[model samples]
Target chain A: MNEDKKIGILDEKTYSNQIHLIGRVGSALLLMFMLGIPFVIGTVYDCMPKFSWLIQPSIALLAMMGPTSVSEVLGYAPVLGSGNYIAFITGNIMNLKLPAAISAHALAGVQPNTPEGDAVGTMAIAISSIITVIICAIGVLVFIPMQPILTSAAFKTASNYLVHALMGSMILNTFGKGKGKTVIKNKLMLPLVAIAMSVAGVLLIPKFSSYQGYAMLVAIVITIGWAYLLYKKGVVKVVNRDEK
Target chain B: MSYLDIANSGLTYTLVAVALSVMLGLCVVFYVKTRKRALELGISKEVLNKVNRSTILFTIVPSLTIVVGLFAMSAMIGTAWSWFRLSVVGSVSYELMAAQTTVASLDIADTATADGSVFVAVMFVMSIGALVGPTLSAILTKPVTQNLQKAGAQNNGFSPIMNACFMLAIMSVIIPIRVSTGGLVGLMVILTAVLLSMLIDKIASKGVAWLGQFNMPICLLVGMLSSLVWAKLLG
Candidate 1:
């Protein structure tokens, strides 16, 4: 029964959607515009300054491109496409005085899987870009020059924890969902697996002691095993049973 | 032009940008609402199969409206308008900034104030956004429920590969599109969030049940507001 179920789940019928035709073309066009305008403007602004008036229009055009009909765009797609631009710009606007990676970390939280926890988490990345930039700018430009001692005291590694804060939020979100069982199981056993494989490799290859292939081999095995188990147990079973 | 005229043009450009986004967004909301209604009302299987198509329409409609609106505004405003012409002015300003810095550098031999320093700064910031957004999207997209609580464990048959691949494709398309010529910054940020969500299938995930797929207007509104501020202050 399990075998049969797995086969059914792997089939293509499960991928069928309910979206309409007009919706498809419309969504594509909107996505193009939303994605296209800012890139053009930013690239132009960054590359050529002769056409400065295009900056605001470029921003306005990009802002208006958010997902409307499909809930898909804002949930995950933006993190990759539009969110990157936001982060990049946020970092740019701050003049890179702020750690640029923080923006990506923040937007990662807006992913749709987490329980609606706090508005801060929702807006943390977006807010952080502005806040960090302002804080850093003041510290670097005004405070440092005016009160070197005080500004130096304020400068600490703690300020850079924006990325960590965002990551913690993501970890918390994943844990809250209770769906990371597979990940947890793998993480727990992987240490033992790693040790065993390392010892075996040393014993089998006398001259290969310097080789790291053993570790790579172990990782491959574990990944393949996990994927197979997930496919057979989760994916296949779900698809086949639903068809019934 | 008089100060009042300049003020009016700026304000008008800002409003028009917002209006376009809101109108486009509203159309999408309505389209989704109607589609949901159809689903609830028991649309035929054949019709249901086309629901995705309808959803696509909501996005396309708003997109077209935005493009047309931009062209119309640009033509009406004239070549010297600053609102929608970020590329043209920023380049010139930065070049001026570079030239000024170069002269200063030549006078003092200070590399920190040179053009090279500015390039590094901008690139560094852009990289940060690229890394964080995708990671966040991936983390947020983890499923809430794994095995069903019923008799036997039944999977949703969700394809992580498909999800990841689809997201990558969506992101790939969106990144270039927003950053391309004539693109706006506000729309880009909002769309980034949207694209992140879509890539991770966050909309379909239970935790963030309210996530939407395509929303150009909200992004545009927020982005425009910020851009306007950026322009007024930084311009």
Candidate 2:
């Protein structure tokens, strides 16, 4: 409600200035501790050899990812808290069963290049890579027991819908700010680039599923490029264009 | 067999999820006020009004939608949670768990329902957990160090400890989250919380940087705790 609190110009240069060093370090340490638990360790061991390193950070990432996904799906606000609960729970929990991606995504806030960003960035990278490994493991684990369930229930179709529903909501929300043409342009470009990159990876690499990072990076880069182009060309003038 | 029975079960968990959400929502509202010191500044009224409007639209409407959606989804899925009668569709892990449970004859095909009264109790308790977690965090971390000068806390080190404890409690619930919703959904749900946090702060740029930063983790922990408790007690 504090009208003065509303920032007029949010430039990309100084997007999130409130990145706390103590907070990021605290979160990272907590994440490392949480990932070192017995149940988590045991689950990683049982799951596969590749995912062993993931058990700890994945817990933290999952903690972060839940809030992000929910907000995206609902077209609401995303949480930007330090990973307190995530760190705590990861350290203490017995049967940590959260997906690996959540943890990776959660740690995304930890931007390590900046003075305080280093911890967060490391945390993010660590957790995300760990999660990717876990997902690969889960794919392998589920292959045998899951085929019957998948074929019978048409799970691929259902999963596609679920993923689409979630991603569609995210796309709408993310590009909700721009003008009609710009929004549409970015929207069109993002999917096309993502799919094209995905297809390229699928053709080039035997295993398409393992290239999640590549696909995600390509999509992100394309979206960023589109946004930059739109901004540069004055296609999307956000909040008080007449001033500058 | 009856519409009433189906409605009753759907109503129970739907309300449970809503009530849990509301309690946590109120806690977030409360934290926003306290951390921002909105009441003292006399700006809370405007924020409250905006929140109230959004609450009605976001909380109430979605709660209702989920209630109806849950019921319809459950029936369509043909396999509902016996205890709560809530829909378990798209949850492959739960289906697998149900398939694997030999002790309870965890029959995925069994449409046989359990006594609905039990879920009523389960829902009530879960709601309480959701309510308690945030309030407890607020109290424990309620900024004992006070300075009339600065807009922020004086860094007395207590806040950090409280934060640690808060995170620890949330971490504890991961096991239960894994058990009930499977690891994947639990992960997604947590990310969803973060996503919501970012959007909330962007919309409500009310100077409460701490709230913007920490709200998602708090909500994630509280929400999961309640959900975990619900799954544990009911299942």
Candidate 3:
């Protein structure tokens, strides 16, 4: 909201376009590399599987993954900004990259959609991606000595609970106010979340657990629509802290 | 060759190394791009550095799940492939699902019987299936991010509220599935995290400057660790 602190208009699009190019090129390269691994095994190692074996499963998996890919990219892209490229490539969007980007912006006292927030998000995601690669490398290097601990019951339990833990902490940020300075007043906010969760608990999870990204995508659309309704109702007041 | 032989071979490790190197290179590229823009946007070096430090700390605990994924997939596939997949375009859920498809179809009881056919099936399926999200993301992210921000700026005062409501709504959907599937331990983890998060916010609000950086990490660790206690007592 600080005009003096924001990117000036002479080449205002400089940051967005530069990041777009980076994201585009980076994405294309990653795709090649990702697909290349399978090609390498097929050609060099001479270990191609029967095409027939893949026929049934490939269709099934694609049917599932296709929608998932669309939903995740569509849902996460707007929020992720320039960081989307690295985030999607590096994966762990829900569990790591998304939260990392959001928190980075919040902790730095930046807004969601500005150049500052986008840049900080990209940087935060990059830092996060690097750490995961290093950790996995370490995990690979020390697998023998670390086998028991990695496979332990306690470790499994904690890993299963990690996402919930992250979600719980992050949800607090939305309820009132933190970095964004603006908030959806709790009058409408409380009923909105409670009803949405009740619907999800009743309708989505039990039926579509395997298809969570898609289900989440649906929830997002409905939430946005409902928010729009609230917007029209004139009940969703968001007075900026500076203006106040 | 035996499945384990190919799965854990020297070449396999080398492939993973090369892939990992490429990912790291991309990360560096992204880091530099954003850092430059952040500076131009009048963000201070001190704040940027704080962002970096905070992000690194925030990432570590959540990355426990990634570590867990690596171990889980390594058992089904191999360490090198597991490492590679988890590093690039692979999630714990997606990788496991893909691997399980190969396992069930091939009836792969153990590493010994998982032949070249099984390995090939696994890799191809995992690689190809995992490509969807990132591939589309590559094509669509810029337009999406740019347009969304543009819309927000053009709109009058509603965008932030919409964003806040959306954030909360997304959490509403996620929390139930996660907690429901998680059973009692999930609820306990969330309760612990919420309390800790509130405490951090309260203290930070009271002018504890540096404490902000550790908020998410502290909450994540205690929340996750609390699961062990909940499971022990309740299970």
Candidate 4:
């Protein structure tokens, strides 16, 4: 009976429905909270921003961040799966939440964009969000004393390199696990080309430096195009596991 | 009241408290729902526990970096507002940029002499500007996931390749920034991390199971440590 129940739970339709329900409700609540903060601050302080005061700053910020925000949602949704709703609200998607979700999926031996992987990713994101709130709360309490140490030059440099280290290691870990020439070629070539192009754009084109805001979007498009071409050429085969 | 006083006022604290409560409540709701769903789906407790532990460990360093950022921001905007922003929608770079842009637009030299009006404007702009990502994700994630699933259903290999490409795109953007700024030292650190991770993977295949879970974090530490050494040698 227990085994039968376990098998029943793996039903794709039921799992997807539940995830959809949770994501919709969670996102609606989060959107409310996002708007509520400013409203609360404005009302409580009795310093509601004038309509005019909001215009220039809003334009400036939107001009800089608008495209990046759109691209982030589009890019991360597929990788993050159901965790996207949770992660978007908690913020820090790039630096913290996404990595945690990926690590959780890897640890559980689940692949991304699947029902099982979605559950694992969601759980991981929840735990990470809880930990982040706790850490930030603690940091606020002891911030005065910790300020000097945290801001020290040595620590700053380390923190700066941290993301690069994390990302580089992740890439190598994925690349090193390739099983054949086809997998290696398909997986490695496009990214290497994209990186080279981005580096050149940064160095050679002064205009590209100003448009660093769109660099990630541009890189993603290039890689996706390359991957699609490979797929069309039959170099990228889609293996159907269920058939086996 | 003065801007700093307003920034540190009881009202501001109340705002933080309210926002924190809402965030916590949502987390609990999501947690309960996700767990119930997972159990009903028949996922083993062992797998769930492993993922939970690994995620908590993975979050520590990055969360601390955010804390470090919060400290800097608090010095500029007062503890209450800084805490509220960073705890919610704001990141270090975005919050700082938003604050600076707001102040500059008003022609204020610094946040020190800025009034409540400036504070309100800054907060408003920051909050509104950040709405795009979460809003779009909330509305689009389901449709997007369904499409990806449909694509995968037709060809399982397509999903994995798409996933790999997405990761590569992100890394390609990040690698250049580090290389551009850190120069030789940054390159050395990144190369060290890549090598360390590859080496760990090789060892893990030989039966060191625990190391596989920790390969990224360990590589991060080694890369940071190597940067210090490189900095000294290059100087």
Candidate 3 stretches with Cα past 4 Å from truth are A1-10, A180-205, A240-244, B106-111
Q: DockQ (Cα-based) per candidate?
A: 0.04, 0.03, 0.65, 0.59
TM-score list, all predictions? 0.27, 0.29, 0.91, 0.87
lDDT of 2 by residue, A1-244 (tens): 4453344223211222222233333333322322222123223223212232333333333343334332221110011122222212121111111111122222222111121222232232223222322332343334456446544433332332232122222221232322111112222322333445554655565644433423443444454454445546755332321333
Candidate number that wins on TM-score, 3 or 4:
3
Tens-digit lDDT string for candidate 4 (B1-235):
5567777778887778677777767766666666666665567787677667667776777888889988888767778778877776678999888888877888888677777767777777777777787788878888888787666545444556765676677667666766776678778888998888889878987999767778777887788778778788874
Best by lDDT: 3
Residue clash pairs of candidate 4: none
lDDT of 1 at A213: 23
lDDT per residue (tens digit) for residues B118-189 in model 3 = 786788888777778877987888787778777766657677655554455556667777767778888889
Error of 1 at A160 (Å): 5.9
Candidate 4 docking class:
medium
For residues A1-244, write the lDDT of model 3, one tens digit per residue: 4675364643567767877887878788777877677677766678888887676666778888898789878877766778889988888888888888877877777656666778888899999999989888887777778778867888888877888888777766645466655544543453364445545555644554566666666666777677777777876667666653
> What does candidate 1's lDDT look like per residue over A1-244, in tens digits?
9998677444311211111222233334333333343344335434322233333333332232212211232232222222222222222221111111122222222222111111111122233333332333233234224343322322212122212222222222222222221222222222233344544554565543223323333333443344446556543222221233
Candidate 3 CAPRI assessment class? medium
